[model samples]
Target chain A: MTDVKALAQERQQMFVNVYRGKIPTRIPINSILSLEACIEYAGANQAEVLWDMTKAEPIFEKVNTDFPADTPAGGTRRYPSFYQILGSRPFVMSSEGVMQHPNVQGMEPEDYDDFIAAPYDTMIEKIYPRLYTELDTDPNTKALILAKAMRAHGDEFALLAQIGARMRAKFGFASIPSSATTAPFDFLADFLRSFTGICSDIRRYPDKVIAACEALTPILIKKGKLPVPSKIGVTSIPLHMGPYLRTKDFEKFYWPSLKKQVEVLTEMGINVSLFVEHDFMRFLDHLSELPENTILRFEYGDPKLVSEKLGSKFIISGFYPVMLLHTGTKEQCIDKAKELIDILAPGGRYIFNTDKGAMDMHGNITENLKAVIEFVREYGKYDNPDEPYDLSKDPMPPAEKIVAEIEANLNSKYYQTWEQYRANHPELEGRPQEVIAKKIKKLEDDMFNFIINLGS
Target chain B: MDRLLLLTQAISDLDEEKVFQILDELIAENPSDEEVQEIVAACQRGMIIVGELFDSDDYYVADLIFAGELMSKAVEVLKPIICSRKKDTIGTIVLGTVKGDLHDIGKNIFKGMAETEGFEVHDLGIDVEPDVFVAKVKQIEPQIVAMSAVLTIALNSMKNTVDALKKAGLREKVKIIIGGNPVTEDSCKRIGADAFTTIAGEGVDICKKWIVNSIA
Candidate 1:
């Protein structure tokens, strides 16, 4: 009989190999599907199956069967698969056992006021009660209930309980990846508050805003306790407040709160991983204060610049654009993968992945996965190639220079000439500038911050 | 000349040490409603700039969140004073995330923005049940009902909430508006909703237009 421990060890070895810039037998694929796709597959409407786990399970099982891979034998195991987990809402799915929502819903202050005015502790407080009341009665029912509830709405629940004992058994001590925490501002804007409200709040109630941040830390810390895998440290996705505010605003509202979270998480020995989603081309310096071995995930960020700035200090993942899977042909995907591998793989602290998940609309997933696998097989070997790649030698111009260029161009004679040229044409009157000079300037500043921080 | 511009720049800079100082100066100087409006407009411009920055990867999520917090603070300070004389009611809205979901970031943001856009919003927070949603509509007598949910599982909760409202004879009284990451136009229709938007900004616009068309 095959040795289970050996196989598990082998899988870990392969993962480490890829992480260490060595080619593995095959690239690992971790594909995530949302509940929408599962609903579509089940031929159900949104309402009929959302509340009932039993109703959504058949479709989930079918999808899993269609895309079969051996369930990991002994590490942290996620039961009911990702699909079942995502589909476990308390509301019933549509008659066809599929998920769908025709109207998007949002709340205002009045809505919250009305809710708080009412008796219930809101929906979050009712989880345990509902689960105990509605779940089936069987010896194994507790485990099933836990699994079903987690599958449905577990992101907020205690993490350890969500991952059943069977699943928890698969992990080794210190084997899981670290958790990443977002700056309070990013957490609220991206997850809690609306972008517009947050921007306005910064000016109106800075103290209240800071107080809110301080208040949330305990809640987040409490939530963080549920998911600390023994071997793998907690890593959070710190999606910085980008595309919403200026750098100075970031320095004030964002950094202070994030620095606090990082301090707490680091002090607890958890790893901080950041997904710098927007232009960090200039903001890397702010991140320099973070402890060493902090994991960095750069999306749409220049890899050359990231390596130059923070490469030696952190474990970096990603730079590949997920959109490439949908837009690029197989050959193009392969070429791009090779290019990334050539540039990012030479260093020991890189892992290959797209900047973000392959979104639902993305196509040619298999081809893209194949491209990544093929590139790793062909070029990821640790054996020194005839021509060693050196990232330090090819430095890009400072981000400030780029920003300056853009600022200069915004007021350049050509732009003025164009405005004058178009002024006579009534058809073009009141039209906004076609060239996004202001946007470029912002990008330049952000990038410059990122680059300058690389040296720090 | 550009009081609004100056205020907005100060807010964006987030000079905490100097924020209160500048705000004190502005309040003491007693800027006119027009001046306040201009500053509000500047803040709006800053939001658009921030949005563009986010879209173009010029700013990070943290920057947007920080700036948003600052902007919200500034607006709060001016809002009470700006509308002291006027009792303008654009419309009333009842909003909540459907039952079995605890995510409220999207809902809270929408609530704040809706208020800014001149709507009286009743925010129900997260995991609201269908019957409760209907009860709120009847009690509040809102002209519009907005629902939000971030999880796919809660999609049914949204539909059920609408269905319950329709059954309770309250659906015709309100324009049902839905917004969230998982929600789309098709989903809105399938769930028997009148409208849907992906972001809070669009939700405000949808609510505003819906009220206008209803009145028309």
Candidate 2:
């Protein structure tokens, strides 16, 4: 009889082969499931599961037991309960089972110099007080929070290890990818600057931004180099704030620290897979400048265009618009999966995941997601993953008409908003000032001038 | 340059010193209500350009933020005089980030822009529950109910707020606009919001156009 370890090794080898740029026997699918979503699936109350380890263990084990056997094991973010124990409220509990992040500004703009001087220390000293306010003023309070956090981490690690072993024994799936931290640039962009802060800093204090991004690099390099390939072949760093920058700003302020972290990780034989957020169409030209053989999971880009450009250099995955899982028919989802496979599966080195991933059940229509994954698993066989494949069995709906109809409906809503506004307010009844139009044109000119120093 | 033009350019340059200088000049003249209105419009013109630069990706999010700060500061200089008289307002807006969401960069920027456009703004801060919003609506009787949320999960809370208002029989009494990263026109319809905007400046414009059209 085959040993379960042998069966687990069999699945592990398939992931290893695919990561090595081989097509493998068939394409592997990632569940990309959030823990909250997993908990919800098992009919557990999310509130109870967050803070209670005993309640959480059974639910997580059940979730692991229920995950489709074919899905490659992956990691989830740190538990909200652990963070709550640390006296940090980074995420507030949404009405849904999941938690939503609050905009927590860790670093003040004035603290840039202090942060640049000692990155880790600054985060602990200056940033933590702001983020975890309860731990700010009282030494005893901080110590208590620290004690709780330590206890929580110990419990969590033990629980996870047990669940992982069970999952491997039961389903031949051991979490293959090592969890890692982001590059310093991302740490600043996500943890410190937040979205609005960094975007402003790029222009307002461009040099300071550069120095701060670089300051985080040594720390990032340290974290990025923590794992050996034998432990986990790939280190996942979800990319943020990169696509939002203008191409020039990316070259100047964002890319250097990121490039260094990836280089360090690569020299150590740990491959880096970037789950690219938003669109990176603007930065496609700069792909060759970075380390090659990297994995890119794009969120909202055109897959065909990505394949056309960086497909040869990077192992590309994703751009399967997850929104379709909710909005489109099941057949459309299948058609889309086939369309992406046809575009990206050629010449090897592609894995398909949800565009932005399905965080919870509501993230995508349940049946639609399952059908697409099952179809891709079966149809994405190496023997005929490519086209001149027949799509006659399920053809796409008229794309233009659907788009036009959606647009028309959205357009009518705008008019309706205005009409309703007028009806709601019976006080004033007059046209918009004619002088305001000229002011608008002048404002546009001034704005154009300020941006990119247009005339210069 | 004319005082109005100088005011616009000062704001465009984001030179707070110059803006204050010009604002003092305009106020020293004890400008008429209509002139004060023109001065406000001039400053708004500059602020609008700053917003446009942000939209076209010419200026950064940081620039939009600085511009908003500049507009807010400039508005404060004019607020006493403007409010001292019986001035015209586009309308009142009750705005907040919904429960369980604390993202307010977009909301804060929208608040500055809405105020500059002469809307009386009441901000309830982040993580506001449905009852708080309902209470604000009942208290202020605002013409527009603006909600902002960045998380997709918060969309459920936004919908809940709408449901609460409907149950309270106050849904039709005000206009609801949802704005933030996770919201879309589809989500707007799903949540029973009259409209949605991801852009802060555009949200301000929507308020102005909606109120203007209402009166017209």
Candidate 3:
């Protein structure tokens, strides 16, 4: 048997080396294998699988072992063994055949008043009781059972008694530390608020909304400090397109807290990974403020822009849109891969990955990864004699010239007013005109500021 | 003086602290609901500007969320008086996160918006069971029953809740709306939901339309 500890050490070293600007023998491949994939692959009945975790465990184990291509290897591979243990606690399926895993504990309280009013032990009493009971009954036995299940899966699984020990040492356990879970903001907005309510609140009671977020941050950070079984830090923040708060609003509510969270985790030596879901190209400056070593995993944002602006500072994990994986042929995938490699792989701070998870048929992950590997093998060399690419070839005209263009565009009688411009674009009808004007002014102001700052 | 234009300027600047201070002076001066709504429209303009900034790459997600926070605060000060003479209850909404799903941020945001729009929202909290939903519907006789689930696995619970509501003979009486990360319009139709919104802002229109149409 291969020494599990030794293998883990090797993988860790490789990761560190890559982060430190050293190229390993081969590019590391890491992917998240959804339980949905396992169930679909195994063709197991959902109800039956939910009833008995042991039954599902074998199937997950089988699929992982058989489909090495699908599984994320190298680094710490925490397989899908826990699915069987958690069982099905309801909220498993939607009317549309979409599967979901609800938290065993229900939604959190709505406002700060509700949150503060609730008992401190509510989480312990309502949520973790059963898990604690099981632990109390046989702590070592349970750990051994989980360890055995992990070991049976081969080199992919590494069992660390507590996942965020390193983070705990650094951050002192005040922050929530669950690497595999979604961020509290996403959990609240996507799962709890529904769409309309969150949107309305964005307009109606924005302060209360910000207060609620502020209140949750400490609690979530505290939860991140928990002891769990795993190596390698895991944290996920889901970015959603929204009811549309303007830039100033974003700076106030979202940036400070997100920056704080990233800073806390990175300070404690936790590998921070963010998954950007929607188009957030507008907020590059805010994103650039994150800790330098943070790993940015983009789902929808443009790769070229990301690489140019943020690539040098952090690890650029993905830019391959899932749509390409489905619609494009293997050759097309390879071409795209080569293009991305040529642009992003320079300076050794890039890791090839899909824009998002290989969810549904759109992401033919096998072909995609294969293409990435092939391209890396062929062209991902640091010592190759290739000309350094210049990103700022066609720079924008001077700020004054740009402002002139804006004025000319605004003045043309073709559209009487900004409202007329919005009317021409029906999609813009739903959005408020004042908001649009404000955004335009801010952009113009920022451009002017940039120009001013450059002169200074 | 183009009150709308002035309001828009205030909103665009997100001069909430300034707006609130001005609002306090206005309230002391006994401003009417129409005047407040006009100002609120201006605040809405600020939100729109931010949204555009987001689209044009002038702002980021954090910027938008922060703007959302500011807008909500500004709304709170104006909501009471603006909505005072208006109908006390546009409708009651019994909402919750499905059982086993611990996400409630979306639900809370929705609740805040609903309340701001003069809807009485009874939030059942996250990981709510179908039985609990049924019980709440029976008690509240809510005009709408909204459900949220972030995870795909929790979607079944949403279906179960709807099924339970139907079984309890409460389905026809209340409109069922759903939203979340994994939920799509097709999923809403598949789950037998009355409507599905991709974002919380859109959900308000869906609920309000249902209520107005039903009442008419």
Candidate 4:
């Protein structure tokens, strides 16, 4: 037990050192086996495990014991029972228990005006029922089912969170605090408009798409803000739809709001990591404009060019393709890791990881994965481990400018203002009122996030 | 510029409104069957320009998709004339997203482009199994069989499908192409596919080269 505690302390400290802009003894590998992968590794049925995550506790332990990684086993980001109760069209569980999100339309083209006018309200009133057909029933039945779904969602996540905390203790997994949000355009594209719908709407109704993204910007920022900001704790933004758009369309529709979100989040001392999906070789200039020390994980790009252009300012990771682990020899996998480490590990801003998480054991062989991770731990050492890079020198945008942007896009029409609520509760005052108000604000924020984050 | 060139330019530019207006004007003229075929051919040429623009990064997948929709609309406008005149399709293709993979956007894009280029496409839809593909190929005898998959697991399905074709003694009759995000020079060889590409335009070009060579 003491040895595990010491190991946890050691791994956590190494993560902290790298995140704090200090050169650690070696490159820290932050790979997490997906729950599906763990389930497969344990030979448990995926559908059975998903239905009752408690059934998979032994599997999680086996994963930790077998597949050595710096991070704990990833829990369910998509809970099937919650969606199953809602008769969800957006998130459907396949026969194999894999949750699949086929393209779905929550908002029609004509609904853009309504959506842009009140994004949250439109989501709750129009989009929710459209996405979850059970929510489209009679008012009484709708409320019952919605409450049941929410309860299921909460119960599932609460159990997963409990298991995750347990695994951290058992395995000495590093706690690099993490939360996730998608880009505004991605949220809009993924939820309100289907992929095909968005592509057509971008051409058929360009202005409306722009206005809709603008309307979504503030809400996404609110969604992105960490409850407790830490420089070492990263807010992950899994970027989608950027690579598929031309550079011109990308700049116009995608970059501005996402760039602003990153600027705002980073300025608040919360580090941001973008899972840069697909090849983003063309957008290096725009990416360079981001604040220094931001983490960029590329799925596909020229590693040498990315290292040359963005390595000095940003923390670079994720050019090692997971596919090679499935197909290549162990030596070939290690050679690829060495190649990426050579290009990206210089100047003290590289974290070793595969380009993507293994969805299941099929995409990667265990021998290759074990070999590459061990190789990185040994071969990625720095001669001088105590050198510190000054991250305090990272510049932030003007405080007033950030405040103004926040103020301008606050879609207050969608939520009940605090002032409005306070006026109605005039009898209560002083510290008691303040305490109650804080609790009420947290509830409102929770509900807001629940509505906004649906289908993303 | 002539109307065909103008139509071509509008499509290349992705001017949806202008494309419809020009198509509507051309339809009202009650032109000969040959002239109508020329108009359809003109729209096809416009899609080629779209493909070129996409390759150069001036356009994107969204642009290609939008252009496809525009082409469909243009085809709808010329459907009457097209029906009146019968012509041989350049070739036929058996296409699918392969087993265990439900992603169809890329497959759909390639189908639209191939149909626009006058290939008769037999789309097997998403999550199509190996025997289904084998059955279709044995039934229709297409010049080419194209498999698409986005998931890495589906690569195994691609190989299985190819192996099934070989087992059924149908592999020698048709050319095979595999495409999607996970495909590379290595996987293509392992899957026993004749060719592979990530781009829909490039895939169509490969299909055309095969047909053209076969004819020669």
Candidate 5:
């Protein structure tokens, strides 16, 4: 058996090297498979495992032992108990046991003005109830269900974390502490307005859509930043709706807020990894405007074009079609890896991954997937892995603009601000006031994140 | 430009207000059934331009969606006249988003465009099981069976649907076309679909060609 400890250390170092804009010994494989895929692959009943997440321990153990990748085995994608307790309309488990997020509109088209006026507050008051049926009840019942839902979420997360940690330790998977956030516009389009609704509102109420995104910018930033910031661990933001918009509409509605969130998170030393969905080829120039070393995993785009355009300024991964893994022979799959590595791995800032994450058991042929990963490991080495690269050439947006925006929007009407606290407790002066204010702020921030996370 | 040409341009532009204004004016003029048919055809031609622009990347999926909305709104203004005309239906299509997939955006877009283009679309709605699709086909005996799915797992469901149709002896009766995020050339062949598309406009165009070929 390989020295699991040394392998884990080496993988971590390689990822750190890449995050800092340096080439590693080989292209790091960060392939992600969905929870359904793991459970089904482990020969467990997916529905049963989803209901009792502890059943997934053996599944992850088997998968981590068998799968060849640099990244660790991920826990459950969404805590089923969390959504199940809340009776979440937008995200519900399908009959097949896989969680499906169908399009749902929590906010109506006419509610745009209200949503824009006070984004998070409106989400709590109007949208949350519509999305989570349990939360739509009277005050006492709503509070009780909300608490129960939170408890369920906590229990599931704790159990999964334990399983995830055990797998990493036993199997020597790289410890990449990451957080997830949605793009501001995607948060709006996904939960508040449905995909169809947002698309319609972009034409019908363009200004309001833009305003809602702007209002969401600060909250999304708070949601995106890691608890303890790291240079290597990324906050993955799955971008949606950009490719569906015209350049003019993208610029107006999507880009500004997203660009702000990325810049702010980047400035905070939190690496931003974007799962760029669909064809974002036209917006390549716009993406180039983001901070240096932002990891972009393209779902659909010409890899050559992406490499030629943004290779020097950013870390590029993805564009290996997962469908090929499902249908192609092992040789064909390896040939694709070679093609993408030749184009993207030439520069130091490339990671080998699939265009999109595997969704279910049908997403990949197991032998083909294993062979492709092994082939990438052998074939993806660099001749000069440690060559010096300068990221300062491509400048990120100034921090002052982002800080100002965040500060302006940080205090919400739904939560008590420090100023409000200061006004309320006039007797407590100086240090006492400051200490209480800090604790209050932390609690408020946590509550805000909890609310916003429910939407995404 | 003539009023018909103006209407075409407005629809193509997705200028909903202008499309409605011109439509309202035509309704006031009490246009004949043939003239109304000509107007509807004009609007569809404009929608074809929208599709072309979408293919060229000048427009987008959102534009296609808005164009569908624009087409429907224009049709609404012309509905009274359209009902009076009693035109021959070009074809019939049974459409749904397939089993275990609740996404209806793509399917709905195709249904709207196909309806405007004069196909009698029996929308079976989202998460439609194989038996539902089979039963719909048996009931309607439509010329086309369109299955849509955004999830990859739904691909198997689509295959199951095709197999179900074949088992029911309805496979040869209708041409199968699959649309959504997951369908590719390989998956289309795997699912035993006759055709596949990710774009609604393209899907409608394919259905139109299928009908035209069948009629010939």
Candidate 6:
């Protein structure tokens, strides 16, 4: 039998090599599978799998074995007990195989002081009651609830560890340390106030927001520095609220906390995989100021320009659009994969990933993704990927020209889409074309321009 | 100075205090119906400007919510005569976040915006069961049903609500709308909704436009 330890060591090294800016023998692939997608593939009952996780192992085992990932998908989603115990009002566990996040604001704007002063204390005492209405019961019952929750969480984590091991044993794929944490501002935006709430806070009470973020910096930094019990000593950070804000606002409101925490993580020799969600083309320069060896996963920014601007400073991944896999022909998908490989794989500090993470088999053409991944592994084999590519023929054009091209594409495509939508729905049949056209125009002129000028 | 213009500026500026102050001043004066009509028209005009500013990046999703809050205040102040005119309300809307999904950030904004756009809105907070929706539809017989959800799981709940409405023979009576992050244009068809949008404000606008066309 092949040694599990050997298989794990081999994959870990490949991952290490990519982040270290040294090309391994070939490319490495990790699966970013969500639990909802897993259940769909298995045809398992959603409520049974989500709420009662003991019934979920066999399904995960089959799926992992079927699609043997080089690095297994980290962080199990079968935490129903933990959620139930915590009275996590934000997340919902329905029988649809999909976990839902309710848009309840965990922390109000006025309560920044309490949060800033003592995060752990406030989260347990104040935030929990507000977030989970069920937990707002009398103190004695609340304590009992907290006790049960804490106990349930222990079991949940234990089950998750077992599942992670099962995948490694059965599929020869080990899980990496998943960072179950976020930057202070990201945490605030996502968990506490939400995007709308934070935006309002920024506009009205910029100082309080800034100060609160600053105060949370040490706490966040300590969390980043803490070791995760996994194969590789790496951390994951998903970024939001940065792309949506103006460059000035991002600089003031978002970056300080993130930078401080990241720098400490770097100092502590822990690698970070920062997933830049939505388009962050405008803030590429500001983000590039981050330390070398930081893995940047982009969602929608231009890949060629991304490599041009931030590639030298940070190891970049994620430009393979998931839509192509879902909709395009196999060849078309392969060609796009090849295109991403051509742009990014010439250097060692590049990893292969989708623009969006995999949620379900429906959203991804299984065969296409498998084929492209296999092809890229062979295609990306390099003696020295650190050697720069020759970019003489098709160099990047002016930013304005690229912006105009994007606008042209949007206007034409959106108009066609608008026509299609109208025909499909009877209500839009006699509606003026101007309504949809105006939306497209706004995307082209106002929104796009605003994003572009954020850096300027 | 035209009070209508002043109201419009106050809304555009997102000056909640100024809006309420002006509205109170107008109320105290015991204004005529023509004057009240002008004030209502100005509020609508201000909401449109708010939408415009949102598109321009001068405002954002939060601003839209804030504007909705302002509009709700204006509506409360104008409640005496808001429903006095038969056409004062463009249409009646039954609004709620679907069952098993307690998300109201988007729903709250939609309620505020729809109310501002002169629709008589009945907001069913969140996690509303399909039967409740069907029962409400039967009771109120609203012209439009607007559902908001941020979870894919709730898509099925939306479908269940649609199915419930159909089961009660009330599907044809109301045009349905759904919006949230998880909903796509395809979701509109899949869930048997007439329209779908991601933006709460835009959802309100779409309903307003449809009602306007049907009215014309």
TM-scores of all predicted structures? 0.49, 0.81, 0.51, 0.90, 0.91, 0.79
Interface RMSD of each: 9.1, 3.1, 8.3, 1.6, 1.3, 3.5
Residues B72-95 of candidate 5: C-alpha lDDT, one tens digit per residue? 877887887788757678999999
Over 4 Å off, model 3: A1-17, A20-25, A34-64, A67-280, A283-295, A307-314, A319-349, A352-456, B1-12, B29-88
> For model 5, what is the error of residue A411's alpha carbon versus the real structure, in angstroms, after optimal superposition?
4.4
- Which sections of candidate 6 miss by over 4 Å? A1-5, A95-97, A134-139, A174-178, A194-196, A228-232, A383-456, B1-7, B15-37, B73-87, B98-103, B124-135, B149-171, B182-193
Worst 10 residues of 3 chain B by lDDT: B59-68
Candidate 3's TM-score reads 0.51
Q: What is the lDDT of residue B29 in candidate 2?
A: 93
Each model's DockQ score: 0.12, 0.24, 0.07, 0.52, 0.61, 0.19
Clashes of each: 118, 7, 76, 0, 0, 0
Kindly list the per-residue Cα lDDT of model 4 for residues B1-216, writing each as its tens digit: 899999999989999999989988988999898899889888888888988887787888888888888988888888878888686899999999888777888898899888877899999997888999999999999999999989877888999999999999999999999989889998999999999999887899999999999999
Between prediction 1 and prediction 6, the one with superior DockQ is: 6
Stretches of candidate 5 above 4 Å error?
A229-232, A387-408, A417-443, B84-87, B212-216
Q: Itemize residue pairs with steric clashes in candidate 2.
A: A199-B62, A200-B62, A422-B214, A428-B215, A429-B215, A430-B215, A430-B216
- Put the candidates in TM-score order, highest first: 5, 4, 2, 6, 3, 1
Compute the DockQ of candidate 6: 0.19
| Model 3 C-alpha lDDT per residue in residues A148-169, reported as the tens digit of each score | 4334433222222132233223
Model 3 per-residue lDDT at B146 = 94
lDDT per residue as tens, model 6, A60-102: 7766666565766535633666566656666766534355665
Q: State in Å the error of residue A159, model 5.
A: 2.5
C-alpha positional error of residue B108 in candidate 1 after TM-score superposition, expressed in Å: 2.7
TM-score-superior candidate, 1 or 5: 5
| Residue pairs clashing, model 6 | none
Q: For model 5, how does the per-residue alpha-carbon lDDT over A1-456 read when each residue is reduced to its tens digit?
A: 469898887777788779888888788988567787788788888779888988888887777667778876546557678798898999887767777788898998877777777777788888999999999989999998888887787677678778878877887777766778889999999978888778778877888888888878887887776644334468899998998899998999899999989988888766799999888999999999999999999988799899999999999988988888887888899889888888999867999888887766564478888888788889987778884334345454343355435645654577766677677887777667667877887766667667777998
For model 5, which pairs clash? none
